[model samples]
Structures are given as C-alpha cells and as structure tokens.
Target: MMISSWRRRRAARRAGKEPRRNENGEMELTIPRDFRCPISLDLMKDPVTLSTGITYDRESIEKWIEAGNFTCPLTNQVLRSLEPIPNHTIRKRIQDWCVENRSFGIERIPTPRVPVSSTEVLEILSKIDVAFKKEDGEGCRELVVKVKSLAKESERNKRCIVTNGAGSVLSEAFQAFSKASFDVNVAVLEEILSALTIMFPLDGEAKGFLGSVSAMHCLKWFLSSGDLSRRRNAVLVLKELGQEKMDELSEMEGAIEALFKLIKDPICPTATKASLTVIYYMITSTSTNEQLIAEFVNLGIVSLLLETLVDSERGLCEKALGVLDGICNSEEGRQMACNNALSMPVLVKKILRVSNLATELSLSILWKLCKNEKSEDGGVLVEALQVGAFQKLLLLLQLGCVDKTKEKVSELLKLLNLHRNKVECVDPMDFKDLKRSF
Candidate 1:
C-alpha cells in the first residue's frame, strides 16, 4: 500500500501539467501529443518520417502504401519512394517516457527490426532457384523457410516477397517437384507450400502456374493431406483462384467431393469459410448444368448446407445460404430442401437475426420452395407456417426492407396467408351454443 502511494505521488510529479482526478479518484495520465502517430492517433512505437515531413507508425504507412496510394497521407505530396526513414529521436523519447512511467503500466517498446527490401527478397528467390536447379532438397527447404520467416516478419516483407516474384518461383518449384514423381523430399514440398501460403492473393504469374494441371495435382494432394495447415492453405489458394478457373476445379476428379469433405469435417474456421466460398462459386458457375447440380444434390449438399446454417455465424451463414439459393435454382435441389426436416426451421431462425444479406438469402430460398405451391401436399407452405414463418415475415415487413426484398416478402406473405386458415386451429367455446349436461 505504501509503495502504491509512492508511485501515485511520483506519477503526479511527472505530470508536466496538473493531474486531474476522475470519478473513481484515480489520476488520468495524458500522453504527449508528439508521441502519437498522426495517422493512427496512438503512441508511435516505430515512428517513420515521410518525404512530406510527416511522421507515422511504420505499419500504418506501409498499409497505406500497400493500398496503392503513393501520395503522403497527411500532406498529399506525391511520393518518389514508398520507404520511410526511422525517426530515432522520437522513438528514443517515447522509450524513455515509457521507462519513467513503468509504475503506470506503460511498456517500453523494443527497437524495430530493419524493414526487408525487395532487393533482399529477390536475392533469396535467386538462391531458391539455384537450389531447385541442383535438386538440393535440403538447401531448397532452408531457403524457403528463410523466405517464409521474412514474410511473417511484417506486411511490408510480404509485399516485398510477392512483388519480387517469390510466388512464381515457389509455384514453379512445386510443379517441378510434382513432375519429378514426388522425388523431392516431402519436407521440401511442405516448406515450398508454406512459403507460398504467406504470399497470398498470388500474383498473375504465380496464378498461371497454379492453374496448370500439375499445380492442380499438387493442390488435390494437399487437400487430402494429413496436415491440417496444409489443407487450410490448399483451400485458401483455391478460393483465391476465383470463379474464372472454377471450371478447372470442376474438371479435377473428386475435387468437388474433397471440398465437401472439408466442409463436413472442417480443418479450421478460415478453411471452412474458404471451402464454402469455393462451393458457392462452383454452384453459380454451373447454374445451368442440371447434371452437375444433380450431382451436388446426390452428394447431399442441400442437407449439408442446411446443417451448416444451423450453427454458423453471420459470414459463414451468409455464404451457406448463398450456396443453398443457387442449389434451389434446380428442381432436384428444391425437392431435397423441402424434404429435409431442418430446412424451414433453420432458414426461419436466420431471418432478421444475422444480417441483411442472410435474411435476403433465406427469403430467396423460401420463395423458391413456395413458388411452386400447387404440389400434392402443399407441405412446403404448411411447414413454413408451422415453423412460425408467418410471424417472422410480418416482423420483417414492419422493419422495412429494400424494394426487391420487400416484393419477395409481400409475395411470401400472400402465399403463406393462403395457407393460414388451412392450419389446424382450436375450437373456441361459445356459451350460447354450449349444451350443458346436468
């Protein structure tokens, strides 16, 4: 208790200005304005000065440059180079202040590492190329690990590694390994893939190699590999491939099944989301292909989608519903959805609960099911009401939706209302009509 009192008194003395007490009777320490980064408005740990004479945290400025803006964030001056010089003076001052304020829980920031350069990344890539040519598996692995280490150091390092053509080099190495009948050590293959994962949103040159048949083989193998991280990276790469190359994915044998397997037995949250995105792409791309849609239905994708919707959070829920909506574009998909007992309940539960897009998707899928209400049982309509779909629809209307969504909601209400009276109701007692048995 005495030590605490001493620390408080010390803090008060160090307060350049008069320290003010808060409602809780604790002194509020103010950070100096110059110690804060202009862009982030937080205490600058690694301050760097731009050519415009404005200083910012290195991470913040690097992100700004990575976003493709070459001008100074504060002064709007055009940048001749993206690099920023470290403001050693400000950093040292901040460190000293942090040391003096240790009793107040402020931590001294460590000196920042020298930022990696594209030239350094290129040199490493060149060494990797030499290692590959010599079929030196161990040498290749070590170099790839080094590159991965650099990529993990900072976002700037990653951009440097990517722009210097690391992706293309690593991709070519993977192809070479695969073409050699897997002659390269598995360790080498793993390291190459690890390095490539760090260089994400693969550049056009890298993507060209990945789109090849050999790269497809490599991806398929990794998707089924025992390593969960490898599986995650494989799906992420596939997601990055986008809808344009979905045809290649469809053509790859068991590729669709393998993706479904990933969803069924998720490797991780990121991997699961990626797999769902890939499936959504595939479904949309094959919208008109009845055979393919039928294949998806046969694989029980509709039931799986409904299952996924039950416990998913907003983003994953949105993607799952999107895939289901595309699946409903086919007759078989609609029948399967209606046949599943969980479909209406899950879809109804998501309404107005997740996000605008999710509500829209649930409504779209429900509309597809109810659009053909003339079926033998009218079960879809009856079941929708049974699941309290009527009340949710009414609430959604009251909440106000877009014109497109409002139209669907109106049509759904109309269809559901038709089956309203058809729902079994309890007989209310009428005293006048009641006959007493005495």
Candidate 2:
C-alpha cells in the first residue's frame, strides 16, 4: 500500500510539470495566483507587500493610499504603516516566468523606479529655500527644475512634495522674486511657478502668501507671458487663490485684458474655464460696480460673451451667461447685448434648453435687457418672441424652477405676452416657418 501511494504521488507531480496545450497545440502558461497584484488583479510589475502581508502593484497601491484609505485592499486589515515593502521573491518569479514563456509572447515587466520619499522631497525643498535666500538664481532654477520633474513623475511624488512644505517654500520664493527686477529673476520665477503648478491646491499658508500683492504681481506678469504653459499655470493658481482678492486682482495692470485674451483664444479647456471662473467671481464681487462692468465691456467682453453663449459647451455657456448677467446690469452692457443680432435670439433659445443654472442666468440677462426702462425699445422683446421664447418660458414655469427663477420666468412671460401681436409664438415643432424666418 505504501509503495502504491508513493508511485501515485510521483505521477501527480510529473503531471503538474507537464506543458499545458490547447486543441490548437500551442503552449500555454497559466500565471500563478501569487504573481498577480491583489488590487489590480493583473500580473504584478512592481509587487510591494503591505504590512497586512498582501502584495499589490506599486502604482495601484499608491493611488489607493493617496485616496485616503489606510487598510489593505484584499484582507481589509488595518495597516501598521503606509510604506510598502518590496516583494523581491514574487517579482523575481514573475521575471523568470516571463523569460521562460518568451516564445508565448510574454514580455518582461521592467523594474519600476523607486518612489520619491517624503524625506527626499523635503530635502529638495530645503535646497530650494537655501538657494532662494542666497539669491542664487542659477542654483534656484536648477532645484526648482528638479522639483518640477519629481512632481510630474507620479501622483505619489506630488503628495510627497505637498506633504512637506513645498508649496509654502515655493510661494515664498515666488513672492520674493516678484519684488526684484523683472528682467533679472523672470527665468527663475517661471521655473518656480511651473513647479508650484504641479503641486496644486496650495496649502493654507501657500494660499495666503500667493494671495499677497507681490504674488499677484508675479501672477499678472505670467498672465501675459509668451509661454502658454506658464499662462495656464498662472490662471490655475489664481483660481486656487479664490475671489476674495478680486478687487486687487482686477486692479492689476493688464490682468483683465490678458484674461480676456485667454477667453478669446483658450489655451486649454481647464485654463479657459479657470479664466471664465475668475471673470465670474470679479463680476459677482462687484455686482453694483457699473464702472467695472463698463470697463469689462470696453475690453469687448460683451461680443466675446455672446460668441461663447452661441458656441461653447453647456458649462462654458452657463459661465458666460453668468458674466453676461452681471454686465447687463449697466446700460452700456444691455445696449451692446441688444445691438448684437444674435443676443436676444440666443438668450431666448438658451432658456429651458440648457441646465437650470444656464436657464436661470439666461433668464436673468433677458430680464435685465427687457425690464430696464433705459433700454426697453420693444424691439428686443419682439426678437425674443420671434425665437419661441414664450413657449419655452411657459415650459420652464410648468417644469418648476427655483423661486427666484420662477419669478423671472413669470415676469418674462408677462413681458413677452405684451408683444404677442407683434410676433407669433411658434412651437419647436413648427420648423418650416422658423427655418423660413431664419
């Protein structure tokens, strides 16, 4: 009986070692379960064992931890430490398997570079501070460039840099450099801003420093810089600084004009939205400041805004409408808006057609245009009726909007009703006549 059992065990081991093949007769190698990261469920490239004894790919685990979870992904075990230990044994096995199965089209996973540690980030920040304090522009430039590279490397590196006081240090350097002669320190300042941009959502201390007069000065300079990337970074940082400082931000030389330029010719979607957001905040902050609104109009904001409302996506259209609402408070803005052939028609078309916010803002602009005695030429109201505003407004009221919006819609209905005889209220289904009018 013992001899028979031994023979059976030997045969089972041999069977396990035999090459696997499908009906097509091609060799197949099933990856061992241990070779896969528990988190990604794929073959581990840079397997690192957690404190919970489970292993995961470095990239996947880092992202998981960055999202604020501190437990192991598989076991749900509380982690003793966030740092993952390298599982060299499993990695070596994976690499060997790749080599053995090279004929099966399996490629080896290249070893990943070590993630930048918080200590290393802090050291770099220290060097940046030293160079900045010494006024060593060349050294500071080099250090900031290194920091920027690390920031771009991975999200892990960004969190590490932000975890240390990199933002505060960089903001300090930016403010200090901005106070100096522009020609001498522009290069270093640009590098610092680039690094700062990567590690965004500036910490509280960083936000305070960047919101200062000097930092705003530096940002204003970058807004008009020839480098598109720097301009984008500057606008993003300006957004992070918030609108509490809009009074100061609007006063910066060429700041509003540069922002208008960015809106006119967007750098990227994010930058364009940031520019629009900043403009929205400025307008909201000074809702009663007619002079500022007219200044924005003089910058050709009205025509640009109308173009945006006509062509932009929903979010951009909403923001554009918000700014337009603020501007139309003044006689000059309402006049420009009414003068443009597309203004009243576009405003009427946007009602009930876009988001609730868009609907509200569009209605607000129309209300301002139609209700203001200074600009109520009846012609604007006639144009709105021609574009089917009456039916859309009725639909908006029935669908129910916020109380404020409901009030505006009702008032708009009343105003449009007054001009019922001038133009027909066409339904959306009445396409032939609508097309003919166009």
Q: For residues 237-284, what per-residue lDDT tens digits would candidate 1 score against the true structure?
A: 888878877877776778878888888888788888999899888878
**Candidate 1 segments exceeding 4 Å error:** 1-43, 49-56, 60-81, 87-97, 133-135, 183-185, 395-407, 424-438
Compared with the true structure, all predictions reach lDDT values of 0.82, 0.82
Residue pairs in collision within model 2: none
| Candidate 2 C-alpha lDDT tens digits along 1-438 | 999987886664453322467689886556666777777778899999999888898888988988999998888888999999888888888888788777777899887777888878888889888988888888999999988888787777777888888889999988888877879998998888888877777888888888888889889889988789989989988988887778888887788888999999989988988898888788778534676787889989999988878877888888788888888878898998888898888888787667768878888898888776343547788888888888777766666677888888888888878878977766676322221111
- Pick by TM-score: which candidate is best? 2
Backbone N/Cα/C clashes per model? 0, 0
The global Cα lDDT (0 to 1) of model 2 is 0.82
**Candidate 2: regions farther than 4 A off:** 1-29, 74-76, 102-105, 286-288, 373-377, 430-438
**Between which residue pairs do clashes occur in model 1?**
none
